[model samples]
Target: MKSKLSWFSVPYVIWMAIVVVVPILIMAVYSVTTAEGALTGENFVGMGDYAGVFLRSFRLAIIATLVCLLIGYPVSYWMAKEGLRFQRVAMALIMLPMWMNFLLRTYSWMSILENHGLLNQFFQKVGIIGLYNSLTGQSIEYFTMLRTPGAVVLGMVYNYLPFMILPIYSVILKLDVSLLEAAQDLGASGAQVFRKVILPLSLPGVLSGVTMVFVPSVSTFAISRLLGGGTQMMLGDLIEQQFLGGAYNPHLGAAISMVMMVIVVVCMAVMNHFGEGEEQAVML
Candidate 1:
């Protein structure tokens, strides 16, 4: 049995080596070497020049994650508390956007948010923009949502909000009803039951959702390119520019990727550390 199981693991091991380990090893080597194949630290050293880009990427990712949390948590909780048919319908609606091509969905957002796009046109037709102009003493024709940092964040939130909702909803839905009953029997109010019981128990899902949302948001290139109009350059854009765009520097791109991987790993580790401590405290 052991021999057979070990034989079965061989295929997976080979797959991991080819797909994951080999690429990482190659990236590590490239990150530390120049185009001439000479080892150098300049790749990492030059990252300081793009500190503002790094900060902006993180700031936007954080905001998007927070917005997803604020919106998704309530929706998840509501879905979990609803009837089975309602939950199914809500889940279908939530997942409907994901069935479409990712780029198509983002492109649709571009159309909706452009200067004379559907949203502004509707607002103008309804006199909402005029009402705002009257109140603010200005003659702005179109709301400038596109080609801005907020547009990038909006794209991130729209694309990744489902990731946040699914994990949290699954966690909340699986919670034992008896636990809530016991809490209530012990004189806990509705808010207290949630704060003390549901909130603590559901934190793992929140952590998972945050990781899912933040990682992609931080590294997203297409959304920033389309929505930010090249104004907001995230790490992904910078890396792409080095490797694929006019910069054409694979070593620097690898260095940026490695550094980003390290930073994300460290941030996630720290976040998990605190989350675990909180979970443990709740357990105690």
Candidate 2:
């Protein structure tokens, strides 16, 4: 018998079209269409903004993604493989920061990282460094910390680490113990078992976590605004500038957003391809 729910799908499809497809269509059109009253080739500008975004935001996103992987993988693996009660505690702790408002979290980092801030104070108390007489003292260069690229990466990591952790944890938790035992039975060393068995088995999680962390971290504007300031401009900040900072160029903003979307899609595709290859190799 034929399914009778075809009519029920219409409302959901229409909602998706209105919410997702329509905006994307508008953005695609805006990316190609020029601004009114502007000079020739001024509005869309083709791939120029995309190139600029690559040069500006690509490096920061890569760095942030790498840092998240480095930090998140170990935490996820440990929690999944070991620490039962502590795993819950760790997950709770990871998510606790998120419970607070995101802006507040970013601002909190500002206070901690500021030269004369609590971090420096704690360091001074521990005799790691001397107390700063001023916020700009040689020992406490808060201004540098406030508006720097490093801060941008730090903020991104702090904000998006949970995304990396959750996916990897899910994978790690579901990993077959038999595979690890079999590797051990075959005389594989600890490192060998991890490298050959655990790592390969966990590839799906790694891919998911990386994509989740990388895409949003790259596009996030709030962290950069609060932490990086004028010195470190990411694609999101640049797009915001076009929309809100007296530029009022929705056409340009749309073009940039479309480019960002393309980059995210391409990166995800490449990662997925690699992940599939790894999965195939593991299966073989």
Candidate 3:
């Protein structure tokens, strides 16, 4: 029976080998070897050149993940407690925008945030711009959010919010109501019950959500590029430059990827410690 089940997995195993394993092996080869194909440790040494990019990526990813958690947790918790109909409506409201392509959505923000964009025009027409201009004694065309790290963080939070929400929501949905009632019987107030029971039980979901958001946010290129105006180069931008941009250095790109992979693995390990191996349903 085991052998029969093993045969059924052949297709998926082959697919992983072709798509996942092959690319990883290729990256590993390039990560250690120079252009002339000589085996060397130079690639690892070169990573030092991009240290700032690595730091920026992690910083922005952490910021975005924390913001998502702060915003998403209460909303998800509320939804988890709501009636089924309200929950569906609220979830739909949160997710409807995600139906569109993420690139398209980000590009749309450019029109709203750019200098001389609709937002600026609205402020100008509403007289707020005039009031500010008079107070500052200067003419301002727009409030520009583009080309800023904060804008990049906002974009990341927008795109990845759903990933953070779903995991926590799933965990909350399955929370045992009896535990809450028991805590209440033991003289626990709402705050005490939440602190002692609800919050502790929700740790697994929170950890899963953080891992989901942070990994993608750290590795994302599109949001950083478009919102950050190609100026705020994070780790993803550095890797893209090596592989696809003017640099055209696959070896360097592979080295960056390896370092990033290691960082991600370390972060996951730390989160798993918090979770106590309690992660459920969320994909890594």
Quick one: best TM-score, which candidate? Answer: 1
| Per-residue lDDT of candidate 2, residues 1-284 (tens digit) | 23558677889999999999999998777766666533344554554645755576888888999999999999899999776788888889999999999999899999988778777667767755544434335654323466788999999999999999999998889887898999999999999999989998889889989999888888878888888876677788888988898767777888788878887999899889889976675455
Off by over 4 Å in 2: 1-11, 37-41, 44-53, 131-143, 277-284
User: Can you write out model 3's per-residue Cα lDDT over 157-250, one digit (the tens) per residue?
Assistant: 9999998998899888888899899999999999999998888788888888999999999999988999999888888888898999998999
Tell me the whole-model lDDT of each prediction, alpha carbons only. Answer: 0.94, 0.82, 0.89
Q: What's each prediction's TM-score?
A: 0.95, 0.86, 0.93
Which segments of candidate 3 are over 4 A away from where they belong? 1-4, 134-138, 277-284
Over all chains combined, what TM-score does candidate 2 have?
0.86
lDDT of 1 by residue, 1-284 (tens): 99999999999999999999999999999999999999999999998998998899899999999999999999999999999999999999999999999999999999999999999999999999999999999999999999999999999999999999999999899888999999999999999999999998889889989999999999999999999999988999999999899999999999999998999999999999979975575455
Q: Give the range where candidate 2 is weakest over 10 consecutive residues by summed lDDT.
A: 134-143
Preferred candidate (lDDT higher): 1 or 2:
1
TM-score of 1: 0.95
